[model samples]
Target: MIRLATVIDTFEADFLAQYRDQLTPDHYRALAAMKHCRTQASPMMQVKCTACEHQKLVPHSCGHRHCPHCQHHESQQWLERQLKKQVPAEYFLLTFTLPAEFRTLAWAHQNVVYDLLMSCSWETVRTFSQNDKPLQGTPGATAVLHTNTRRLDYHPHVHLVMPAAVVDGKQKQWRTKPRGKAKGGYLFNHKALAKVFRAKILAAIETAGLTLPARYPQEWVVDCKSVGSGESALIYLGRYLYRGVIQENDIVACANGQVSFRYRNAKTTRRERRTVSGAQFLWLVLQHVLPKGFRRARNFGFLHPNCKHVIALLHVLLKCVPGQTLAWVKQRAPILCTCCGAVMAIVRTRIPSPFTGQLPISIAAEGNP
Candidate 1:
């Protein structure tokens, strides 16, 4: 199978040439990470399984979260840490969206808009949760930011895993509510949130006095969802961040120095076509993928910022403890014992993903044409 990294690396130059006119610092950083993944290495060990005698040198993975291949181990480690943070209270899946009018602006200023989206969403949740009618305590939540729609369009949004209830300060009570029970919770009362988000963004724009187009809308587009809790939501969120916001399946092809991709209508799921020059295609891909150090998925509230402490306190108070967590995450077959179906016990160590084969150029061909 052709790794996505291979495709990205081979076409990176083509992408840069196309996006040269629109390149930014973030784009450069993302390209650099993809192109130079090997430099940042993790500790890998080699050993033969005592039970199965499966001999192999296990290659270490680069721990960079942006690389899909590298995230499996890290994701498992994170989930382990989060187990301690699971509370008995219900959880709410909250989403915040921006209107179509801000599309152009968000594209031009990704760093700014992305930052604003997270900050504003947190503000809205905090405000509502702390209101006298709501949970009232400092309701903790984890917010993950996604920059694309199902079809991989640059439609930035934030997904928040909010506790169905929260505890504020030293108060001795825990508030629990069903997801979607809050008035305008799923809708998030976009009319009011739009005003708050718009005001926050407008203030920034005014402070910066950004150049605006002639036709800008007064209203903002926002959406919220309160998906119920289950294994489905966690699994869904995990895979949601897996592939590129824009998947290769949607990419038509690169020909005639141009590239075409498909997108689906949000409301209708109808396929829509978009074509760009080869360079433009490269630009779009590079622009949409996150920079190396920038994390698209973030944990907040009780799930982050010392999840151990907050969760420990919550557990002690709530008289709860999560089930046993997993040991080291399960790696793929290449590293596992074929006979025993278990991680090959570590014996020795090596640098980089273990070099399983010789370089293609190093192998001499029998004859030359």
Candidate 2:
């Protein structure tokens, strides 16, 4: 596998020279962290073997959310939390996409535009659920914002995993969409969903004091399809939730002045490869680096963190077992000692690099009298 750090180290100078004017502080931060992640240049921690009196210093991971080598545990934790909140009802995955004309505007004001995209999408679904004859109440959803397509293009959209059920707080009841023989299942009319979503987002953009693109399409695209049980969809979204846009395994070749990577085509459902210059490839990945402190995945309504009690009550009311449907998350492997085959426990951290003008504690003690 071609590591992203190797590519970054190889093309750093050229990439910086070409794109320095356009790079943001977040992009620079991500680059610096990824370039040295788990490498000797990063800080180190001293770990001692539990069984034997042996110690060694290991390089620390960058812990950046965009670094592919880190945050596997966090991604799994998020998935488990979502799984625990699952209820016994049909689920749907709705995609609300910002049109191509709005890409430039979204890039310029990503914080505002992305926030509106997710919030407005939930609001649209909430409205439809409240107005529906069967489910006349508030609905919950787990919304994830995806800024890249399968080919790593700058396409901003929000994918919402919503159960076709609503909680009527006023009536103190739970209601689910009627099941029929319509193949996978059915929810709201997707065409009507598109219309309402378009109006809400367009109005929201103007309300946020941003100008709409003059040549934007009159019709926006919103896709809603049934995902039975919703476990597989959640797993799919969790795959890239904490990791960066592209995984290292997908990076097939990095030779000469160009890099190549593969992606599964959404239309054909087949693997396809794209090759671009090294600098351009770095830009393709870094361009999706979200702003600092910006959240990519969010829970809303009954699924919100504050509403845990609601989820608990619904679990009992719906007679749904939390862990029955989804498979258990495997525990992370512990770092073991090479000498005794025992788990190593960290004793110290933030050991300075050799280039930092300060020597590590052990090295400094050795030099002293």
The per-residue C-alpha lDDT of model 1 at residue 71 equals: 58
What range of 10 consecutive residues in model 1 has the weakest lDDT sum? 360-369
Task: Give me the runs in candidate 2 sitting further than 4 Å from their true place.
Answer: 325-328, 355-369
Q: How many backbone clashes does candidate 1 have?
A: 4
> Best candidate, TM-score-wise?
2
Candidate 2 lDDT by residue in tens digits, 186-245: 999988999999999999999999999989887789999999989989998998999999
> What is every candidate's alpha-carbon RMSD to the true fold?
7.2, 5.2
TM-score of 1: 0.71
Give the top-scoring candidate (lDDT). Answer: 2
lDDT tens string, model 1, 56-117? 65545544444445555455555554444667765567667766777788777666677777
Clashing pairs in 2: none
